[model samples]
Target chain A: MPSLFFYLFTAITLGFGLLVVTARNPVTSALCLAMSFVGLAALFISLDAYFIGTIQILVYAGAVMVLFLFIIMLLDIKAEEGKKPNLPAVIGGVVLAVILALQIVTVSSSYSLGKTPLKNAPLSLNKAAETSVLPTISNDLKVGTLPDAKLMGLTLFKQYGFHLQAIGLLLLVGTVGVVVLSKREKGGQDA
Target chain B: MITLNHYLIVSALLFSLGMAGVIARRNILIIYMCLEMMLSAANLTLVAFSRFRVVEGLPDYAAQSLVFFTITVAAAEVAVGLAIIVALYRSKQSVEVESVTKLQG
Candidate 1:
């Protein structure tokens, strides 16, 4: 990825991220967050994690943001207009954020490995194909293509299959929990 | 040239922004959005490392798989969290953080 595009996406991600923080209205914050996620997905693609990037958009920008919007509209939350801001918390939050950012910058700058550019660590498709067990993966790599999704699928099923099933179970539990939590009580009694 | 540090810096800044939002925003829903942003920042870091660290002559797929699980879990979390928020709203009739002071003692 070119440095220009990297910076462009970085700006998009962080800029909208800042908006998400500062926007008074919840809906605006949610929309800005969606834009930030889209930019983040672009950054993932730049890293050559194509499948991750695609799902970042699909799950976050598509499904997740829609859920946020639905809840925001359903709750009928008005803009926090005329409310006095919590001065101490605001100051503390900004200071804490700055401190954390500076700490990461200092540490990463001194870290030797982070200095390497993408070009220096180019994917070795032919070499990977030579050792790959899956014929489809090997074939795609042999053809000078990066089969990102296929590789990810293989990794998940071959190596982390159990974890995948656990995630499925977690999702099922979450669904049941949501239904139970939101269900109206008999006789309209508050919990 | 975009080094791994560039991505790292971006991710760090993004994370900081999310942290600030979580602390400063009074709206519970926006706070949840900020939490998602922080999660995405972590995802960015993992993907960046996966790209920069080559394994077996290919980018490591392990980190990407972890990111996939993270996304799935985050989605489920959002569903449950929003449901909880709806219940809170139904009971308290407000989404402001100040409204949920029952446990503030």
Candidate 2:
């Protein structure tokens, strides 16, 4: 049953992903990409990464897609209705992608660790509670729940706090860079 | 009954599709969207590995943290990329990849 849902979500994701690639209109492509992100978020949830899944929806499907649509409308991009695709690039891309996919499938199928089922490596709440330092996290674990978001927050702040700060700096720089890049020159000259 | 391989296979396929899109599509925005798809595929792989690899009897939060960072960076990247694309459009007045041939030898 779970596998059924997994396959269903994967189909949804890949199908919409294909549409995003093939659709001529930018708005249609953006909407299909949003649907693809939603499907990918479902796959994340199936893996028990509930927090990641939620943010995948919030960030990718919600914020990122909206940004894309806004940009598409702002640019007033018309559909490539009559343009001929570069045929050599299309053929090469399809062939290369197929080869890469097959290689990945082959490697993953043969990987010993990947064959392990989720049930075989179940999360032991008692053991987690034993190892946990925080009362809230340990309490949740003790009560038979996986405090995913709390644990994620703890992990981010505890272990990767510096990295988190670095990411924040990166985002700030990105914002400034966008402002600079999009700002028009005052003297009617391209900078 | 799904194993880690199932997730990996899905991720691989998604990444391949994105690769094809990036290479074949002429529209810079669609190519950018494909890049986002590729990033999401990597996130799926990371989350799957995080779930299967238990640390302290719970799913490894470290990998999940990396996924979080990846998502953040990707968002930032999209903003910067789109801004550049918009700038490109202002200068060239076209989003087609075949435009902007000043660098071509």
Candidate 3:
């Protein structure tokens, strides 16, 4: 059932994602991208991470996409101008081909090599046992003060708070900068 | 031999496609959206790794936490990127990168 959700959302996301890339008009492409974001959020939901999915919709699809469309409107870009068929495309194409070939080679080699399973291992052995150990670290961080979510929250606020604040400040500055940059002189500063 | 490696290859494909979109497309808005898609592909890989590697019940949520930060940064990028695009449009009639080379020289 969850796998169904996985396949469904993945298809939807990747489909719209393709549309976003292949669409000619920027406006239509942005709209397609909004749809893709919604599908991605749904994919996150299937992983049982509801918070991330909801925030993905609210922040990315809702606010961020609106801003993109707003800019699209402000720019009033009808058709793309002087869109020279990227002659430099060969450089990028070669790079992509190399990267993808490397990936394919790596995966193919790894697959053929195969993972060695434990000899005569008990079927009762847990696969995920090693991963859950990190939570133990949080509890030992000064006793009962560290729940998983609380530890994560505290870490964000205490350690990474400045970076968060910096983003906000940067947004404010960018807003001011855009306004100032767009405002033109009245007199003949014109060419 | 459909395994975790298969999933990783798909993720890689999605990522490369996104990167190519950013590089090949002339539109700035599309470039930004492609960037988002690239990030999504990376997040998918992280989740896949966590699902495969983590043993149940230990409360390990590092991948989830990292994803949250990735989303936040994406939001900030959109805000700034849109503002710059708007400003650029107002100064110059077209949004194509080629046109902006000379400041009306």
TM-score ranking, high to low: 1, 2, 3
- Candidates arranged by DockQ, highest first: 1, 2, 3
| Residue-pair clashes per candidate | 0, 0, 1
- Tell me the lDDT of model 2 at A104: 100
- Those runs of model 3 whose alpha carbons end farther than 4 Å from true positions after fitting are A80-84, A87-105, A108-191, B1-7, B53-59, B103-105
Clashes of 3: 1
Q: lDDT per residue, candidate 1, B25-48, as tens digits?
A: 889999999999999999999999
Off by over 4 Å in 2: A189-191
Those runs of model 1 whose alpha carbons end farther than 4 Å from true positions after fitting are none
Error (Å) of candidate 2 at residue B35 is 0.4
In terms of DockQ, which candidate is stronger, 1 or 3?
1
The residue-by-residue lDDT of candidate 2 on A162-189, one tens digit each, is: 9999999999999999999988989866
| DockQ of each candidate, alpha-carbon based | 0.82, 0.79, 0.37
**Whole-model lDDT values for every prediction:** 0.94, 0.94, 0.65
Error of 1 at A58 (Å): 0.2
Question: What is each candidate's fraction of native interface contacts (fnat)?
Answer: 0.88, 0.85, 0.29
TM-score of chain B taken alone, every candidate: 0.98, 0.98, 0.85
lDDT of 2 at B92: 87
Q: What is the TM-score of chain A alone in each candidate?
A: 0.97, 0.96, 0.63
